[model samples]
Target: MTQKVDTAVVLAAGKGKRLDVFETPKPLLKIGGKSLIVHTLDNLKKAGIKNVFIVIRKGDFVQKRELIDYPLNIEFIEQTSGRRGMLDSMLSLEGKIDKPFYVTVSDLILSHNPYKMFVDCGVAGSADTGALVCFDSRQNKESGANTKVLARDGVIREISSRLPSYNALDLGIYYFSPKAHKSICALAKKDKTISSVPQFFVVYSQKEKIRSVEYSGDAWFDVNIPKTFIRAELYLGEENSAESGESKKERTSLKNLPKTVLLHNKKETVTDITVKRNILERLDEYEVIPSESYNSPHHIIVDESIDSFLGKPILDKLLSLGYKVYKHTVKAGENAKSINSYVKLSEEILNKGIDKKSTIISIGGGSVKDMGGFLASTLYRGIGFISIPTTILSQADAAIALKQGVNGGDGKNLIGSWYAPLKIIVDPATILKLDERWVSDGLAECIKQGFAYDKKLYNLLKGYKGDMKDLDFLESVLKLAIEDKVRTIEEDLHEDKIALVNQYGHEFGHAVEHLSGYAYGHGESVAIGMRVSAELSYILGICDRGVVDAHIELLEKYNLPHQVPKVISPEDILNSLKYNKKYYSGEPRFVLVDKIGSVWRDKTYYTVNCRDEFIKQAVEASYN
Candidate 1:
C-alpha cells in the first residue's frame, strides 16, 4: 500500500467463438445494463488507476468503437502474437509498460476491486515480487477453464488446470512489475509456444518469488463461461434486493454454525514432522503455516496464557523464515472451546487476509487442539490441519484421532465433526516440561484405554514407578498408550462403531467435567466416569465386584480420581447429560464394560441406554 501504480492492462483479445451464442466480442457482451468492458473500467477507477490499456485483436474496430466514449486514457493495442494466452496479450504491451502495473484478463465479473487490495498489500518495485490473485478451488469444487495453482509458502511452484490435489485457482488477474514484463517477453520468445501466463510463471517462479495472493468473496466469476454468464445475470437482477444482501456480506465466516463435514481421510501425511529436536529443521519442507487460510497452508494454534506461551518458539522460527503470520490468541482451558471463541478467532484471521488454501498448526494441550481442529475443518470448509500435542493427554489420545469439535450451547462437543490432521506431532520436550499433575491427567486416559480395551497397557501403567520428570521413562509409558490407541482408532476413524470404545469414560466424564465447571481435569473426570461405568456394569451384572474394586485400585494408584467431588451433586451431572452428543431418543447412552480390557456391545452399537436413576446411583457411588 506504500506504493501506488496508476496504470492497468485489460486483455480483451479473445474471440467470442467458445460461447458460440455470443455474436458480440466477449468484452462487448452486456450484463446489468452495461457492457462487460465498462464494468472492468469502473472497477479500475474505484481502485484509483487512471491510465488504462485495452489490448485487443489487431483489427477489432467495433470493440474499440464501443469503448471510445468512456472517460479514462484508453490506448487500444492490436495483439498479434502467440496462442492468444496472457503472454501473447502482454507481449503486445511490450515497451509501453516499463513500470509496475495491474493486469486483468477482461472477462472476469467481480464484486470488489482487486487492484486496490493488491495495492494495499505492500507492493514491491521489483519484477520477482509479482503477485497473482487466487482463491481456494476446493471450497466450491469449481470445474472449468480456471487455472489451478499448486504452491508452497504462498509461492507459485507449478501452475496448470489439470493438476491433481490442487488447493487454489487463479482468478485471471495479476500484478506485473516493471522488470517482469520485459523478462516475460524474453522467456516467451525463447520458448516460442509458451502461451499460457501460468506456464510462464511456473518457469519464472523457480528463479524468483511469485506469490499467490488469496482472494474470496461473492461473484468473482469468469464471464466467458456460459453458465457464469447466466449466473451473472441472475446476480444483476438480485443485486439491490434484500434477498441479495449476502452478496456484500464479508466472507470471513462461511456459514452461521460450522457445518459438520468429513474431510478426506487423512493420508497420515508429513510423517517427517517432529518437535523439540531442532526447530529450524522444519524450514527444509514447510515455510509458512497460517491457521485456517489456504493462502497459508501452515499456521500455529497456541495457548496464550500469561504464564504459558506454548507455540511461541515455533512461531519465532516461522517468522524468521519470512512467513506471513497472524497471532489471534485465546485464553487457556475448557471455556476456550465455545461458539463465541471460534467466531472471534476465525474472523480475526480472515480479516487479516487468510486465504482458504492454508494449513493450520495447533500447539497446546487437548483444549487448544480440539478448538484448532474445529477451526481448520470449518474455515472455508476444511484446510490442512497439524497438531503439536504438548501434553500427555493430547499426545496419547486427543492428537491421535480425527474427531474435531468445540462445545456447543450447553453440551460438550455437541457441535463438531471428523477432520483428519496432516500429522499429530508428539514433542517429548513439551512433555518433559509439563507439570506432574498434567502428566497424571494424561496417564488417566492410558488407564482408561487399558481397562476398556488393552489390559496389558493398563498393567504397564500400574507397574511404572519411575519419576514423571524422567523424559526417557514417561515417554516409554506414552508410547505404549499411543500404540494401543492407534490399534483401535485407525479402523474406525470416525468412531462409528467398535471405536466407540475410545469414549469408555467420555460419556459421563464430559457431563461431569461441564457440571463441575471444569474444576476437575479432563482425565480426572474420566477416571470418575470410569468408576461410574464399572459400578453400573457391576449393578447390571456385567462385571463382578472384584472388577469394580480393581478399577478403583488402579485409578487411585495412578493418582487419578476414582470418585466425584462432593461439591457437585449427582443431579447436576445428570442434568448436563441431556446435552451429550451421543444421546438418542432423549436417552443417555453409555459404553459399558463387561470386564476389564473389554467394551460391552449391544446387538449393534457400542453404546447402551442407561436409566437416569441408574446413572444417578452410579454417580453417587463415585462421590467422595
Candidate 2:
C-alpha cells in the first residue's frame, strides 16, 4: 500500500556558481513562464502535499515575492551556514516535518505524472525505508557530471556525485519518514564534513534500505547550469508534444482540419494563416513539404532569443523524421530586421545549400518573420516559407500581414516587399510564456483593429476586462483580430484600397517608435498613436466625440499608454511624421476613424492629408 505524504521540503540553497553572471538564484530562474520553485511547489500541491518547507541561504529575498500567489502554506527556513550541506538544509526543518514527507530539489522540474508515480513507488514496498527517483544517466550527455546511483533489485546500493558505475542517475527527489530522518540526523552529525544530500544518501544507503523509482519519459529535467537549463527548456517542448495524443502522421494530415483565413491577390489565393495552441508539437501535421522536391533540405531560420522555446523542438522533430535541417539564428527583436542583418542571413541561407525548393521555417516574433520572409522571397528568387510566430505582437499583427521588410533609420518598414508565407502557424501556448507587457503591446493592435473595422471586437475589448495573462480571452482576441486583419487585407490586397484602414495608427506609431529611440515598444507606441489619431480627428471635426472618448476609455482599460512620452516634443513628432511611409508625395496623410468600426474615407482614399499645425495641436493634446 502507498503511504500518504502531507509535507514537502524543497532544497533551494545551492550556490549556483556557474550561472553567477545571471546573479539570479538558481531556483528563482524562470522556465516555461514560472520560476523553478513555483513549478516544484505546484507539483507538490498537485500531488496532494499540503505543507511546503523551502530552504534558502542568506540574501535570498527575491523568492518571497514569487511565492505570494502559491496556495500552499509555505514556511521558509534559511540555512545561514556555508559549511552546511544538503542534509543541513533539510535539518533546518527537522522538527516541523513530523509525517512521511516529500523532499525535492527546487531546481528539478517534472510533470504531474512523475511526482505521483515517485510518491506511490516511495511508499509501497515494506522493506523500503525511503524512495529515491532515478533516471538513466545516458538521457543527458552531461548527466555523467551529476549524481549517480547503483541499485540491485529495488534497493539503492550506492549513491555519489561522481560515481563511475553504469547505474541510473539520482534525480534528487526522495520520500522519507521520521525514522529515516533520525538516521539521517545521526549520520549528518557523525560526518559534519558532508554538505550535499546525495553524498549523505550514499552513506545512508550503506546502512539502510532506500528504494529506487525509475523515471521514464521526457518529463524530468535537472537544471543547475546554463547548459542544463537550455536542455530542460527544450525537453519541456518535447513534453508538451508527448502530452498531445495525436500521432505525427495523423496531426500532419490537413484533410479534416478547419481551414484558416485565406489571403488572396486579385483572383488567386495567396496563402492561409493557421492559429492553434501547441501547433509546434505536431508540426508534421501540416503540408510543409515542397511540392517540387521532397529530397531538398529544410532550412529553419529562428530568432536567437527563442532558440530554447521553438528552435530546439523544430530541430529535434525534423531531425527525428530524417530531414536534413539547416538552422540560421538571427539576433532577437527589431534590430535584426535590418538591411545588414538581412544580407548576413540571406548569405548564410545560400551557404547552407538551401535552394529555392527548400522550406524555410521562420521561428520568432514579428521582426524574425519580416526578415525571414524577405530572405525566402529573395532566395533563388523565391522559396517555400513557413512562419511560427512566438510573440503576442507577432501573432496579432505580423502573422496576418503579407509584407516583410527591414527598418530604415528614417522610417519603419522603409525597405521591404510583399511576400506571403506558404503557411503561418500561431501557437497560443508558446506566446503564453511571453512577458505580460508584450502581450498588452499586442492587444494594442487588437484595439486598433477593433476601432477601425469590427465593433464586436471593439466591444470585446471594452467589456470582459481581465489581465493579459488570461489565455482564453487572448485566444478570442487573436482570432477576431486576425479575422479583421484578413478581411481588410483581402479587400485592399495592396494598401491601395480600403485596406489602408489597417494602418490606422501605424503612421504615428512608427514615428513614436523612431522618436523615442524605441523607448516605447511597438504596442505602447501604437496605443499612444491611436489616441493621438482620435484626438486629431476630433480637432478636425471629422470624428464623433463618442469615438474620441472610446479611444481614451478603451486604451486606459487595457493599461495601454495614451500620452506621448515627455522626452518627445510635439515638434519632434511632426518632424518624424514627414518621414512616415503613409505620406502622399510631400503632404502627410493619416487614417482617421469616423467612429468605432468605421474609418473616415475620402472618396478613393481611406486617409486624409493632414496639415502640420493640426498634427501639432493633436500631439500637444496627447500629453494631456
Candidate 3:
C-alpha cells in the first residue's frame, strides 16, 4: 500500500512588489472578503490535511495574526538564516515533517482543491517519485511561462531553464514524500546556498522519476501580476453571490471569459468536438451503436496501423455491448488517400450492407478520414460520419474543417468536397502511441494554426515539448486548436465567401507536396511553405522582417524544417503553385500574417494575389 500525505507547507514569504497594487503581503490581500491564505487553508482542510506549516520572512511576523483563526493545526516558521527560495522554506521543517507533505505557493486563488485531485491520483503512494501540479502555460502567459517543464508519460524529464519551448508550468504545488525530501536535501547540502524548488527538482530528476499532475479544471488561478489579479477578482466575484454592490458592467465582464465556456454553457455550433482524456468513457453520448440493432448497422473504417492503439478497445466495447460492428481496415499513409482507394473502400462498405441508419465511423489520420469521409458523403448520397482522428495533425487541423476528399492527379485535395462529420472524438491516449516523427507532423500543423489565428495558440506550440503521453496537455492543445479552426471555418465554410485565413501555409505547402512527388509529408511541406509565405509577405512590403524571423523562430523551435530541400527546385514549386487547386485564373491567392494573431486580407478577396516575381523571390529565399 502507498502512503497518504496529511501534512502541508505553504510558502507565503514573498512581498507583492510586482503587482504594485498590494502594500501588504500578497497572500493577505482580500478576495471576496477572505485573504488568499485563508482560501488556501480552506482548500487544504477540505482535502483532509492534518497540519500546515506557513513559512514567512523574519519581519513578516505581523502577518501571523491574519491566519490566527484558521481551522487547521497551523505552525509559523520564520526564515532566519540563509533563507533563499521555496526549497529553503520547505526545508525549514526538515525533521519535523515525517510523512509526505503538500507544498504550494500562497498566492494561488482556487475555487476548488487541486491538491485533492493530485492526491487522488496516487502520486504520494507511488514508489517511483513525487508529483507537481502543472497547468497550461498558454492560458495565463505571464506567470505560466515563468518555469518550463519537460515531461513524458506524466513523468518530469527536466525542470527549470526554457528548452526551445515548454507547455506545462509548475503551479508551485507539489507532493514531496520522505524519499524525495531526503534526495532534495542531499543535493541542497552540496550547494553553497539554498536552491529554488525548480532547480532542486531539475537535479533530483537526474537520479529519480518525478510525476507531473496536469490541472484540467477551470477554477485554478495564480494572482502574481496585476493583469491576473484583475481577472481573478472578477472570476471570484462572479461566483460569490454573497458579495453586494455588483454592477451590470461587472456582469458583462463575465461574457469575456473563453467563449466556448461561456457561463459553463457551450456555444451553439454546426459541429461538436469532444475532447477528453479517456474518450471511450463517453462513447454512449454519440449513439455510437444503434440503441436497437434491428435498425441500420454501423460500419467502421479504421487505419490498420492504429488497430492496436485505438481500434481494439473501441471494438471490444461495441462487441461487449452486443451490437454488430463491421470493420474495414485501410492502409495508413498519404498514398492510401487516392480516388482508387476511395472507390474500393466504397464498394467494400456497400458490400457490407451499411445503410443510412448505420453511422460511418472513421478511425485514422487525415488521409484515412478523408478517404472514409468522401465515401460516407457519396454512398446512398451521404450518411452519418463520425471521425476518430488518431494523429495530432488530423485532430488539430483537418478534423474540424469539414473538407473531405481524395488527391487528384494535379494537386493535393483536388477532388475533395465540403462534407462535415456528425461528430469528432479526439482521444489523446491514441496520440501517445504514435512515433515521434508522426507526432512532430501534427505539431507543424498546430504551429501553422497558431501563426494564422491565435497568438496564444502559436505560443502553446512554441512551448510544446512533444509529450505525446501528456493526455491533459494534449487534450487542451487539441481543444484549443480545434476551436480556433472551427471558428475560422464557420466564418468562411466555403473559400468563395472570404479568404480562409486558416490556410496561412497550405497554398505553398500543397505546391511543395505536389512538386516533391509526395516525398515530404503534408506537415513537413507546410512548415517550409509557411516560411516562404512569411518571406513573401515581407518582400511584398506587407509584413515586417520580424514577421519572417518569427516564422523561422517557431519553425526551429519545434524542430520543423523551414528551408526548402535541395531536391525540390524553386522553378518546380512555382509551376506547381500555378496549377494549385486554390489558384484563380493563373495567379494563386496567398494568406499572409502581418503579426502573430492577425492575417492580411486583400480588399477584393480574403487572400492577397501576389506577383509571380515576388513568389519566385520568396521561394528562392526559403532555400538554404
TM-score per candidate, chains pooled: 0.54, 0.56, 0.55
Angstrom error at residue 541, model 2: 0.4
> Which is the winner by lDDT between candidate 2 and candidate 3?
2
Candidate 2 deviant stretches above 4 angstroms: 1-269
In terms of lDDT, the best-performing candidate is 2
Q: Local error of candidate 1 at 369, Å? A: 0.7
Model 1 TM: 0.54
Ranking by lDDT: 2, 3, 1
* C-alpha positional error of residue 534 in candidate 1 after TM-score superposition, expressed in Å: 0.9
lDDT of 1 by residue, 1-624 (tens): 245688899988888565544457889887766888898899898887889999888889998899898889899988886374678877778888777788887776777677766755555343345555555454223215467777677677778777776767777778888778888889987897676788888788878788766664555667765545644644554464544567546654566776699578645533323434333336435533433343353556677762244566577666776666565567788766888988888887677655657767787888888999999889888877878777788888888777888887687888887877876667666766677788889888888888888887777777778775677766776777777667777677678577887888888888878887788899988988899988877654456788889888888887888887787787888788888767755667778787788887533457656456667778887775
C-alpha lDDT values of all predictions: 0.74, 0.77, 0.75
Q: Is candidate 1 or candidate 3 better by lDDT?
A: 3
| Model 3: CA > 4 A from native | 1-269, 281-286, 290-294, 463-469, 496-499
Greater TM-score among 1 and 3 belongs to: 3
